[model samples]
Target: MTPSPGRSYPILISVILVGLVALALGTQPIKPIMSNWPAALNIAAPDVLALPTAAPPAAISGAALITGVAQAQGEGETALEVYMAQSDVQEDVGEGQVRFTRRDVAGGALELLVLRLDEHTNIRVINADGATPGSDERGDTTWTDGQRHLRTVQEMTTAPYALRENSELLGAIAFGFHGEPRTANEGTVVIDGQVLRSNPGRATLCITHERRAEIGRFSSEDLARCAQAIGGGPVLLWDTLIANPDVATAEGEFLPFNPLGEDFVQLDWRKKIYNGRYPKTAAGIGLLESGESFLVLATSYDMTGIDLARQLRDMGCYAALGGDDDTSTQTVWRGQLTRARDVRPVPAAIGVYVRTQ
Candidate 1:
């Protein structure tokens, strides 16, 4: 406790060194530690923090699939192909017989049941005026009445019609600018060489005595040679694109050029009639580049006539003719019937049949 000055100073120095070591261990301050460390010591600072990357998205599966046209296998052999999202199935369809089922459209999202008939198929026209429910004096054909007519036809004949869709003529009661008969609705309608209705403008699908089906603007002279005819449309295509002069007065029978050039410009008639813009449903027949005939029932999303024509052309159609549309659009294949979402009673329909051997 009362030691000499030199000895006490030495002891005090040792105590101060120990206290500094304890403080260094407890605080661990970088500045203080660096000051005390040797200048030769080198250390890297901690790397900057980084976020981890995310995983990639998963792939989609079970997409829709479609098939090409089936070719005839051999002599007296015809093949039918059904396409769908799952797979393509082929069946041997016999002559004078029809095969039909719900299938996906090629390169499209819509599912439709298609009926295929042989080359010698017999088609018929069912006049809506002929089948009216609970009336003997030929009342107007309602949608319900049309269905009843289809049922009656199915029951009466063993060789039933394979497909049915609304024709181009408007009913007497259904008033509209689009459906209104372009010509007098009082003309003769012949179906499969049988006169169904003696009404003009009733010739939608014209079949010659040779059984060749022609669809377009037909004159009375043309009808005189036809064994069957039903009323339908403004021809969309005839060998080449049919120009609507009204679409653009300056174009003069040429479709007005769109900025993209791939699509058709909006027409004055479409804007005026369809209220600026809206989707349109239409039925049409086309002659393909491969000399094969195709029937198309299209539902466009806010498209004009030019747009429709462009699409048909892309689909390999050299010629196309539009038929009745809107709520009147319907397709019946085999026993299964499909009506438009907004159903309307049509005055007439075009029926496809297979002739018996």
Candidate 2:
């Protein structure tokens, strides 16, 4: 059964040095959990979680990033968050735990949260209600229209799925219910072996019950064994090539936008999101110096799928997929959420969490 988020972790030592400086200069040290995280995710609560950043990456374009620009920086927007497109910026949240990276492009900015996959770190798929996956017809009307169910991402990660220290969210871009009614989530969603929804044939991200990660067009047997899995795609970056990223749904339709969002959000249900520029988010595995790791990215401003794929490829991602474009793109890391326009509550998400065992 899914429970609500009702827990908090004690302060860790990584930020203590910064905290000491805060104490010395009479300034408040930055904490792992942000106070307004829950509110940012549209969750009604006293406490919250996060979405963090790292160093600014190589500029993808020639846009001058001069001013600080951030929609909801922690405690509020630091000047850096405001005009980040001017230069690349990143921060070390936990020395050996979760690493945050931020990069700026001409018309947009990208934030990446990296969590090493060891015995202690892992990933999971969350559904707003314990039972319904966003793609399923049984529920999650919030994505198709208004939030008639009143569920939040917080509820999606409650109780049996509560997080420990150092956790981050990856946008899978479950799907925006606009355009043709036939266009919906392309694949299936399976949590702990219980199939929440199913479309079967499509690109899939599978995390074994034992927590091994794999991405491919899996067979029925492969998907059934998955402990946590989310399937849908117009693959963003696959095998070093820009995979099929032009389609939005199983029907091969064009950008199917969320009506709640602006009409010019620049989204394509099919391949158009990749072809056009708009706020985007992506999730995939990266080949880091240490080993294979999971990475999530969010961008404010505007960017194309090609640029996003190149950026992920630049970051060493062997494979990646666009989560969704425009306001459907949101993330939470260390109690912080990425800044974007048309921020809407998502019914499904793939999150990185700390293992209690």
Candidate 3:
């Protein structure tokens, strides 16, 4: 019959070829479990299949200086808690570890630390350029001039110039809020027209009793209360202290020390004095008779009152007052060395006095 039409030599050859392919595949070696995969291809294997120990800590470069005002204590202990900034990693010096080199805000600069979370950072306070990075969305309605309107504003215009003006005198920055107690340092300390420099990272601000008063940062009414508590009184004239002559001068006169003090009383009976004299009046007191009303300078801390009186005596304006707390006040005023109508002549240096009104 035609050699059984269904079975041909070509068909048998095709079947054999298919069977060989199947056999080859079945006999091939099983891919070693991915754990056994070739070294070159196993880049991201889990621990069960890992070939090496844990990776070393990611290398960080010093190029990224994560700067923020240090809020921890300057205790110098390796507590790990004192050196951290406002973020996760803090700079510190441990047993053989080196923290950032501590540089003075200026010469004779001191630093303070705060431990509260969710607080505005020192950068935000001192950097006049800092802005809130988040958004605030609240719909509100107002009627003015017999009209109704809707407003959507995210950021509020804050006063940074004020902060910049008082930066040097400020020690820290504290957020000022309404309806708060006179918690931290709150009152105001009036100084001579000695202009202070406001530097970032080194300023200190504190809030007080007023509905909202932040000193250095912002001050509220509470500060007034603190000034009152200090037993405010008339300005004392002591010939022992003199103004810093290195500062600005006018008509051969240095700005008086604590020129802005309000309660001023000239206790010195002598005639003349140098502006930069300290509190030992050995010679004639330097004359601040510059005619400035608020020619007093404010200091971060207390000074030797008696010694200041002595210095004023050495200058021409010989006579000193023992008005300790009287030098403190609640009002803020400006004083200068110019003999202009608007400007008042600062008192002599050892002539630190309060102008009590």
| RMSD for each of the candidates | 33.0, 22.4, 28.5
Q: What TM-score fits each model?
A: 0.45, 0.56, 0.17
Q: lDDT per residue, candidate 3, 1-357, as tens digits?
A: 677656787788999999999999999964311111122123222212111122111221111121111111112222222323322222232321222211122122111111111111111221112211111121011111222211100011122322332222112112211011211111122112111111111112221122111111111222232211111111122212223323332112222332212212231321122222222111111222221111112221122332333222222232222211212111111221111112111111111111121
User: How displaced is residue 216 in candidate 2, in Å?
Assistant: 1.6
Clashes of each: 11, 40, 97
Candidate order, TM-score descending: 2, 1, 3
Q: Write the per-residue lDDT of candidate 1 for residues 1-357, one digit (tens) a residue.
A: 689897899899999999999988889742201100121022121111122121111211111010111111111111112122233322213421333323233333222212222254444555444542221123221222334332222222223232333321111111111222221122235555654332222214455675444543333334555676654333444333333424432232233221101111223443342322233433334332233334434444344555655454444343344444444445544433342354455544555444433
Off by over 4 Å in 2: 1-96, 134-186, 244-269, 288-291, 297-300
The TM-score measured for candidate 3 stands at 0.17
Error of 1 at 86 (Å): 13
- Can you give the lDDT of residue 5 in candidate 3? 50
Local accuracy of candidate 2 as per-residue lDDT tens digits, 71-173: 1112111222233333344554345345556677777667766555555666666554433433323332123332333223434444344443554442222
Indicate the residue-level lDDT of 131 in model 2. 34
Q: What are the runs in model 1 whose C-alpha is more than 4 Å off?
A: 1-119, 129-188, 194-204, 242-283, 286-304
Query: What TM-score, to 2 decimals, does candidate 1 have?
Result: 0.45
* Model 1 lDDT, residue 109, Cα: 24
